[model samples]
Target: MILPIVAYGAQILRAEAKDITPDYPDLKELLESMWETMYYSQGVGIAAPQVNKPIRIFLVDTAQVFERMDDEEKEEYDDDPGIKRVFINAHVQSLDGDEWAYNEGCLSIPKIREDVLRPEEITLSYVDENFEPHTETFSGLTARVIQHEYDHIDGKLFIDYLKPLRRKLLKAKLDDISKGKVSVDYKMTFPK
Candidate 1:
């Protein structure tokens, strides 16, 4: 099933998500649905909060980004292109390295893209779907994707990093998203 993504102004998107155990209700089913929804929405990552579930869970598939990049473009990145993984109860322990800006967009806040600055490296701890815990560091585009989705679970949006003036400039479009006035190929639940 493809879950309807929660749009801007949705309270769930603003609320911090709680961690869940392997015993979470229908955990496998929800993961399947989230993956389906992410692909259908053409998103590289999706958080549980985006699906109206206030849980610390997200999926990242940077292979999609790498596949879309041409050879020349791909060379700019590190040797590791991307990784497909599930993060549950993820927490970023450290963020280091130089900062860089990337064009970022969100499925919940459709039709809006902004250049957001983020650290180049991240060290985090999270568990897999089966409840196996792992602490790992990520770099490059994969790190960026993980940070973006991790923000969703922490009640933060990429737009929140925009300058005050820039965010104000986007107010109208943001309002349109909350009111369900924007057009997107994927299904969304608007707050208004």
Candidate 2:
């Protein structure tokens, strides 16, 4: 089932998510629905908070535009559907110092976009859906997506990266969003 995605300005999106332990049976089904909802929303990544579930879970599909690739030149890795990765109780082990800025948008934030600087590479330790532990290094867009989704577990948002002036400007719009005074068009365009 495709779960309803919580939009931007939703308080749950900004709340810290609780960690799901290794022995949970519901973890399997939740991960499955998250992947389904992500595909339905045409988003490469989805955090648990985005689905109104404040758990330390996230899904990623990074077969698209990479951070180092030119926006116009990059293409989706293949015609095949993306491989779904379920990261549970994840922790960043290490990361490269080099950073890159990318214009990122969030499902919660509607049409808002902003340049957020993030590590270009990182090593992470996480448990997969099978309860097996694994550690792997990731770079480029994959690294950014990992960090972005990881932050959700800690109650962070892409909007937190905005400069003070930018945040000030967006305050009113955010207010309207949370109050349901404004509506968001969910149509999303993904890179080919």
Candidate 3:
């Protein structure tokens, strides 16, 4: 099932998501639906809040990103082999290394992309889809994707990192998105 992504201005998108226990209703089913929705929407990552679910869950798949890179680029990012993972109740233990800028986008804020600066590496601890605990560090593009999704669960948007002037310039577009005035290929639930 492809869930309707909650668009910008949706109350849920601004609310901090709660952690879900292993027994959360239909956990398996919800994850599956999220993945389907993500792929259908051509998104590398999706968070529970994007689907109107206030739970700490997000998925990331970087295979497409890896595939698009040339041989030289792949060599530079050798450690990143298109990781695909589900993070539940995730917490960033630490972030290290110099900050780099990456163009980021979100399913909830469709058609909006901006250069957002973030740390080059991060140490994260989270439970997997099966509720198994894992702590790991990520870098490069993978880390960037994870950080973007992590923000969603924390009630943060990439645009929030932009300069005030840039945000102001995008005000009309943002308002259009909230009112379902923008065109998006994927289904979205705009604010009422």
lDDT tens digits by residue: candidate 3, 1-192? 999999999988889999999999999999999999999999999999999899999999988789888888888663557788999999999999899898888888888899999998889999999899999999989999999999999999999999999999999999999999988899999999
Top of the candidates by lDDT = 1
Q: What ordering of candidates by TM-score runs from best to worst? A: 1, 3, 2
What lDDT is obtained when candidate 2 is compared to the true structure?
0.75
Those runs of model 1 whose alpha carbons end farther than 4 Å from true positions after fitting are none
The best candidate by TM-score is 1
Candidate 2 per-residue C-alpha lDDT over 48-100 given as tens digits, one digit per residue, 9 for 90 to 100: 88888888788888764344345454553222222348888788899886777
| Better candidate number, 1 or 2, judged by lDDT | 1
Q: After superposition, how far is residue 13 of candidate 3 from its true place, in Å?
A: 1.0
Give all TM-scores, in the order shown.
Answer: 0.98, 0.83, 0.97
Error of 2 at 173 (Å): 1.7
Tens digits of per-residue lDDT for model 1 on 1-192?
Answer: 999999999999999999998899999999999999999999999999999999999999998889889999988777357999999999999999999999999999988999999999999999999999999999899999999999999999999999999999999999989989999999999896
Better of 1 and 3 by lDDT: 1
RMSD of each: 0.9, 5.8, 1.0
